[model samples]
Target chain A: MADASYPDGLLYHPEHDWAQIDGETATFGITWFAQDALGEVVFFDPPQVGVQVTQGESYAEVESVKAVSDVIAPLSGEIVEVNADLADAPERINDDPYGEGWMVKVKLADAGEQQGLMDAAAYQAQLG
Target chain B: MVAAPSDTLRRTALFDRHVAAGARLVPFAGWEMPVQYAGVRAEHLAVRARAGVFDVSHMGEVETRGPGALAFLQRMLSNDVSQIAVGGAQYSVLCREDGGVLDDLFTYRLADDRFLTVTNAANHAKDLAWLRAHADGFDVQLADRLDDYAMLAVQGPAARELLAPLADGPLPARFHTAELTVAGVPALVCGTGYTGEDGVELLCAPAGAPAIWDAVLAAGVVPAGLAARDTLRLEACFHLYGNDLMESRGPIEAGLGWCCKEATGFVGAEAVAAARAAGPAERLVPFAFTGPGIPRQGNAVVGGGEVTSGTLSPCLGVGVGMAYVPAERAVVATEIEIDVRGKVRPAVVADKPLYRKAA
Candidate 1:
């Protein structure tokens, strides 16, 4: 009975990508807004842990009960960790998206990339 | 901004209208169709409570005219077409050689020997080709009416009130048709709908459909899009052609055995009978989530067998969906789990069409 609606604490991209930064490393996943749009998440095709991803580039695929959607990366970086947990529990993105639903952690090429991304409030305004 | 590649998306005459209304258009069955005008759940609830209009012009309309039309259709569709008297419409399915469903369609008996078969929009070309291939030497003339007309469905409890001003009279009493003029546009109004509500479908000239649609909207009919249509159909437990029943499964497995006639020798009759005799491997049944997460399509169905179409039922207040499970697991109240996000959330089997708002 967890809300699948939007959650704060993560920056969002119009395409549903989100970025959470800790120093040079940034964790990324689809926002709750994206999960809500996708309905129910059933499967996730994640990129490898060491794969390099660019800002605004699609690096993963998520399948819902309705159709397949792409999961993009928010900031250019090398993927430090891929949320293996999502491979089995994709609904975590729908349940606690900003928390456990984190899809990947990246070693950022540029920490300034976060500034270009929309904050939670700005992303919510974009949705409106 | 650069536009998306112009895919061969066949659109209805109301395409411009939908776009102007800010509809999110997606490709559905080779057509650039609207998935949602506003949102899925909102439009869905609008139709359930108020009046909603749907531009179902994408659905194919094929006429079986000439002297032997009824007889030809009798052998073509699964439901008893003979029972559909003139001016009445009946819902039926066109089956394949193996008794598998090619498409679920609506048969309208226009006259003594002239009938119209309204099929799914995506299957228009395919259905026409299949019908033509099977229709050889039958004294019946099959003409694809796809280009000649536009179809609009006005659905909900207040549908009658909203459309009566546009029509010649009240809704033609459940599947019955009435020749009428809406917004000065001539149309055929039939009391039939996919949403399982008391509604009517108006068929008229492609250009005239928009006028009628606008007038009906002016009369308080809400313009609903494909998102509402889908959820409404799902809640009604109405079977979707490509999602629920396809060439891979039959009426038996889809829990549509009631429509299969024993006396009729229609196309795929043999296969249907054989399948019935042998018993189906799986059955389509409704399942609701007892746990947190929602279950979606293609997600593994555990404790049953195979999973089919799945989605979150906003009305159910929990995750409700459908799957092809073993006969034993398909039973009402049977407990199972939908493999959502790799976690198996417990669910209970319920009857199809989880939401029914009367007839």
Candidate 2:
């Protein structure tokens, strides 16, 4: 079956990550497609909750059974709430990468940074 | 079917056939090989429950024939090749005299004087050159026939049931081979595989691979790729060459002590014998997590002041892994911790072959 996608109100990154902005808070997670290609997420290496991230820079890593891949920052921000749920249940990334699998919530360093990332159609083309 | 990239790593003879069958092509060992047609977990379950087909033609096939073939192999390999009866196969390693592994391979005893060696794709040339350089006075003809032969592995419990109908004769009783016609194509069906499952590896002419692939696919056999193969093998606790075992590792250290038969005076005899006599300093142990975290390869496995390879097992629902445990922590069921993120999670020394069918 085809996988589900992140719901509306989320900004997507070409690298298959999502940034959902709520006021100054931005919750982020990988897209459904990224988790599928990664097989199973065995381990995660996210920056500390208060760590700062720059758009386009790799601020975290995810290791699957077959290979290890990086989780790039979607927008410049400071981590406000890193998903504590994922530290114990990385499968959340595999089962629901966009929801409970939310990787990190950020206080957007610059709201304008959203323009650099992809929208739904653009990210879908990246899959092609 | 997906359009395969022209610049994709070179394909085996069955490349086009795999693409046509909707097999997912991925780069493996520098070659374009199908990872799966349906899906990795699906194909893996099929191979476990029913049957699945795998295109392993990318693996190198080396032929050593003539009078001194047996002696030559006996000297180059760590296992006693001379012990294998005709039509039998022995899993052995090509080793340097220093006891380091070059490549772990299967040696097929085609005849009393003829042998076929299958090495991993990445180590083909090195294995061949090592054997050739050491063959100074041996009377043998070595040929690299990998390009000429295509190997198909139909594996699982129902492997024989599915293949019996396609073959002209009854399936070869386990580990034996038969000269047969599969889907009207001339083929040699040998019972062997890497998944630790019951199966046959069909070695046939390059021209016949396509036909054979179609015949198997048409029979409802799931098409599996390296992804499934890796997980399946991991479930069986089989070591991957580059990961679990390598040039820096020895058979004794890798839990392959059985293959280091002392009877054969192979190249690494002295070192292996010494290591065996002295006892190994570290041991490879299978472990699993019940709490939280899936261990990936290269993750640090901490126990008794030692760190080793920790990886998630695709077969076992839990995080299973292999690691070099110090002598103290090598005991079965010893507790250990795997560093997942900054948290050192609890893990247990689990049983080997964490996923195995009833005997």
Please write out the lDDT profile of model 1 over residues B29-110, one tens digit for every residue.
7778777775566677788888788988888899999877877887888888889898998888889988888999888888
Each predicted model: what fraction of the native A–B Cα contacts (within 8 Å) does it retain? 0.12, 0.38
Q: Which docking band does candidate 2 fall into? A: acceptable
- In candidate 1, how many clashes are counted? 6
Error of 1 at B15 (Å): 1.5
Error of 1 at B166 (Å): 1.6
What stretches of model 2 exceed 4 Å from their correct place? A1-10, A32-63, A75-128, B1-8, B303-311
Cα lDDT of model 2 by residue, A62-97, tens digit: 876566787888988898878877776777888877
Q: How would the docking of model 1 be graded?
A: incorrect
The C-alpha lDDT values of all candidates are 0.80, 0.79
lDDT of 2: 0.79
lDDT minimum window of 10 residues, candidate 2 chain B: B303-312
Residue B305 lDDT (model 1): 65
